[model samples]
Target: MSKRNFNKMDDDQIRGSSRVLRSSLAKKGGHLDEKFKKRKMTDLDPRSSQVRNQRGRLNQTKVKGTKSLAEKHVSTDAKKGKQGTKTTVWSIKDKHEYKIQLPLSVDTSISWITGCHLMDSGEIIMTDFYNKSLKKLDRTSATVTVCDLPSIPFGMCYIGNNTVAVSLGQKLQFANISGDMNLMQSVDTDHYCKGLTYHDSKILTVNDNSVFIHNYNGKQERCLFTYDSNAYFQGIAVSDDGQRIYIASWNIGLVTIDNKGNHLFTLSDPELNDPFRLSLDNHGNVLICYPHSNIVMQVSPDGKNEMGRIIKATDSIEWPNSLYFDRNTSSIIVGCGGSAYLYVFDLK
Candidate 1:
């Protein structure tokens, strides 16, 4: 059985390379923190931004909410849509969602849906890093199941057949989703495995400032490239043709690289300032999530400029931390941290 070929995250099947990229996301408390939830989810003023003056090839956007994202700051193509940024983009009518944080889990900490993928069956598979588990959401039936993991999972990339690869700090864990979620095997990594993707039967990973490619058996092929080693890297994605690769540079902004490990360009704009995760759309657009600002935006297919904000806080998107685009449904699945539901938007 062949796995679905994802558009954005080779790394979300975010398809990866690295040992040095580090994030504080894995640490969690045993109990829910009501105050922390409110502060993290809604404390940010989503309407607090404006279009910064355009400079060179990219424009700096300081936006707050969806409506206030300043559509004029984007390209001509993105201005055509009032869809992806709002709830109207969904192809499904049912909005009610099953809870991702399950009671059957050992860890009682508040749930955080950190990574996700849309299966060919229109179902969703998600990784709860805080809970140290995987969750399967059957949209049609409205049922959810959870499976425990050996360690905290970071990011996910689909391998093939009903199987996926999960990043576990120092290792890449593989599991099958055909039956009850089960761990199949794991490949140890000398570097801390953070953001990941699968391309051409190879695994690409990133951490610290380096990206590496590996085989399914965990043999390092070669290092792709490195960025400002000092800057933190989070999400990673690869194009459909496996020619272009994108990385979320937390402090700097969006960066694109070629398959041969050459730096193509770096998109540094205020809008992408705190980018967390990266995904791609059917059109080859790079979707980026900014938690502090609470928005989901995208870069044009060429990686030169932006299409526009696909999502804002107004769309019930509060601190969207991770994202995945379902080619089957032409929908974008958003993982909002500390929330009971995952937000879905249609690109159709």
Candidate 2:
């Protein structure tokens, strides 16, 4: 073998010379040297090594399949180069310009507003866990006591035009409302019911850490799934298509489950402390109430990202525990757990 001097050649020139030599040998039908063939091949160009490393990183990110929790909460419109300074897309103002406060009945002092649902007739139905009663408030700010429950009510959701399902203790009660509330039937469960929602003609109830499904006629269906033992499940909501179910846990944050009881994902944030209740917007986004944080947040349907803060704590929203998106008026009805007033925000 003849030794070639390469000290004077540039990087690209050396690479080109090597390629030319290899091609010339191939044209002559010459075989590679045994030593050269036995040597481990390595990329000679730094750029080629860099490109290969970058591609490997991209493949790893694709395998992960989801953004990190910190990245998901960041605003998409934030400044690209700013490190530590993140500007939120949504802002909360103190003045109730787009908000309306409707007070409940003067005779009834609500201690904890746990559940709320918007009716087709523009009336709002709420459950008072401390008072052990369900109340209805009309559009005109007129309030009426619907009915009293045997135990503390935790969550509620609308089943039909005039039908509602409420979770009270270990029993799930389905009631019909006209001028007054009447209990149609009740289904008994093994655990105490804490949150309830209707989806795909089935009743989804959260009893302790487990979730149960039932029919409307007081028949026990299937115990769908359960969560972590340490997690205290508070609120539950189902998608309109009945393909997904969202649950709010005090310990582990918001969890998403499929219709067949498969765990999909969990969304937890340092800002989203104690997610208590859940509701779905018209666009199929998840709206969660953080009572301890005194804020209401809107998250994406996949539970991978937070859309924005719908209600901020500085906006005079005190301990909001329940959320109801009223499609008729395009508003959000916020029920406070520590306050007596209910706030309504005009959805923009």
Candidate 3:
């Protein structure tokens, strides 16, 4: 095995890689469709989130594929009331997190992991944009296996039966994670894709302003309402029942939309700057992060209440991104972009 260390490159090799990365981004920028071209890349600034703050409370949730004992939970409460009004009582606390070393097998480039998903089998999968590969971390043996991709990748989600769909810039590539990592199917999108999620048998992807919904067979189904460029949505999360959609907008805060594509509300916070990713715990609450700000927070199901801080800069989170609230394990899995550590937080 090649020597697998975080600092695999000497000074000269690191500098060369840095130059190549900048040039590559510039080349890709020439094809932007005006909307994404004008938007500020909030996630690329590693120092944006610099303040050290106290931790936020992570909302309580049930284990995936199990029953929730909390009666009239957050998801149900929204449906019982008017269109968007929701009263929430959050039962949350500071989560206990421990960083684990993910040894790489195939590549040595600085790992800019953009997405992570914990499978039902307890293995974790992630998309590394810097290395242009997909990696699977086996929890039992602490062994990692890799599958190279055809292009730079973005977000991804777990499709059933040992399969996952990854977001390429203009396409959605589905691959089987069971073995061989065979390319299963590819769905062409209407726009360059960023954040992606699967809900109600439909796949959802985002650009600077619009959310494109696609059918399972790679067909453009329908698009939700397109907000202005200020929306700057890149990360998305859907309620378990697929009724509410939470989009992370870098310019604004979280924007809530209903199933029929109506804008329910846009929730902004002064403390919120450049929100980048969104995930949901099993029970129905939303989880989001500011990569540059180095913080992760939990929000109520209706997108009205900010639950508490789940993680913060004081907790040693640096340039945090590629966040996933793993429903299978009922834990929050975080991959810090450009770092070697993968953090798994056990919810209290």
lDDT of every predicted structure (CA atoms)? 0.62, 0.61, 0.65
Better of 1 and 3 by lDDT: 3
Candidate whose TM-score is highest: 3
Kindly provide the TM-score of model 1 when superposed on the true structure, using C-alpha atoms: 0.72
lDDT of 2: 0.61
Model 3 clashing residue pairs (backbone): 49-292, 49-293, 56-309, 57-308, 57-309
- For model 3, state the Cα shift of residue 116 in Å: 0.8
What's the distance in Å from true for residue 90, model 2?
A: 7.0
Clashing pairs in 2: none
Q: Which stretches in model 3 have alpha-carbon errors above 4 Å?
A: 1-105
Model 3 lDDT tens row, 299-322: 888899887877866777565777
Give the candidates in order of lDDT, highest first.
Answer: 3, 1, 2
User: Number of clashing pairs, model 3?
Assistant: 5
Q: TM-score, each model?
A: 0.72, 0.68, 0.73
> What lDDT tens digits, residue by residue, belong to model 2 across residues 42-89?
211213321112211101101112211111111111111122212242
Clashes of each: 34, 0, 5
Error of 1 at 309 (Å): 0.4
Model with the higher TM-score, candidate 2 or 3 = 3
